[model samples]
Target: MKKKFSLLMLMAFAAAYPQDVKAPDMSSPKWLRNAAISPDGSQIAFSYQGDIFTVPANGGSALRLTIHEAYDSDPVWSRDSKMLAFSSTRYGNKDVFVISAGGGVAKRLTYHSAADVPTDFSPSGDKVIFSSSRLDDAASSVFPTPILSELYEVKLAGGMEKRIFSASAEMAVYNADGSMIFFHDRKGYEDPWRKHHTSSVTRDLWLFNTKDKNYYPVTESIYEERNPVFAGGNN
Candidate 1:
């Protein structure tokens, strides 16, 4: 069952990012997606072929981690670069999991039967933030949903998850001070014909302050903006 779901996820992803995915050059054979630099900026980790792998920042042989038959992707390195947090479908449902950066057994961190995708790690490396449908009261089933995906944070040692925002967003990056998180928001629709349909998909960047519990638009343009990260300085 877990293996089947993994295949399904890969199919969905392929449909979504097919144009963006480029065939690897012979010199570098791996087709990488969602590559993120470790907090220290020393190494980079990314998902490829349903697993997480890391390589040197300057370039080197990719080291594979988490070999489960189920899907594993969206790898985020801890602040110290000692552990990696990512989402996997190995437990028969999409949930967040963590593993040592060097390589080790992946431990499940979330138990939502619905999808859970880890987006970022806090600056302190004590917690992980992800998007999930688990908190929806009407979402008894995973696939069909009127409820939007919300942002949540969970302790690395494992504990109750905390809801931080109510919006369907993706590719979140934390502020250096951990006071705010930036993400791209989008709405989904059932109708396939409408040009501006929910599924038509327009995204924009947003910033949510953890302390004030408020969300602010970061971009005014209608064009889809995604994966915003703080370049330098403490915010």
Candidate 2:
């Protein structure tokens, strides 16, 4: 009789919770991610579900920075710590955008058809660097989309974008005085589970001279060494 009662309870529990369903809290305030600290170290910016938020660096209630139906993430702060640059799909494609660090309406910066992910702020903090495949030479024969990427910069005050670097250079950042740049020469550097796998396609660190547009390898290992930035960061 005890065995029979236990079996009945098990069936009831199975019926209450289905295996294929996701929990309601999967996309809530508890799911904040992609956090970045401000240049002055006073605040932290993060993404929750599909919105962007800012909270005190010392820990406090998070303040929502973006409230929209589209997803916004990958936030980077400007040097003066007065503005934040992030990526958003609000315009149908992921593009560069900026908002007040204190919280306000976000302004779209990039309008390319391809994905434009914000990498970092310019050394002067007057512009933002983003990685994308907006070049004319990008491979399009692939069934879905091209994988090659390049870097570009757009003014924070809003203006035309300027091509910074050519294909295969991404997740790039500038030094304090904008005299040099640290970046990776790989397209799939963003893949989450690519660790311990070394090959000819592995991402390597490269330091670029902004003045003469010359570059040299910082790391030549087959292992991944992408997304190079300063200790405290250029911005």
Which prediction has the highest lDDT against the true structure? 2
> What lDDT does each candidate get?
0.79, 0.81
Candidate that scores best on TM-score: 2
Q: After superposition, how far is residue 54 of candidate 1 from its true place, in Å?
A: 0.6
lDDT of 2 by residue, 18-134 (tens): 679766674334766778888789999888888888889998878888889999999988888888889999889898999998888889888888899988898777889988876
Candidate 1: list runs displaced more than 4 Å: 1-27, 136-147, 190-201
Q: Would you estimate the TM-scores of all the predictions?
A: 0.77, 0.81
Q: What RMSD value applies to candidate 2? A: 5.6
Clashing pairs in 2: none
RMSD of each: 11.3, 5.6
What is candidate 1's lDDT per residue for 1-235, written digit by digit as tens? Answer: 9999999999999898877667667776567786989878888998888889999998779899878788888888777889999988888878999999999888889986778889888888889999886554354243435345777889989988888766666778788888888888755543323354232356678888879978898875645566787886555
After best superposition, candidate 1 residue 187: deviation in angstroms?
A: 2.3
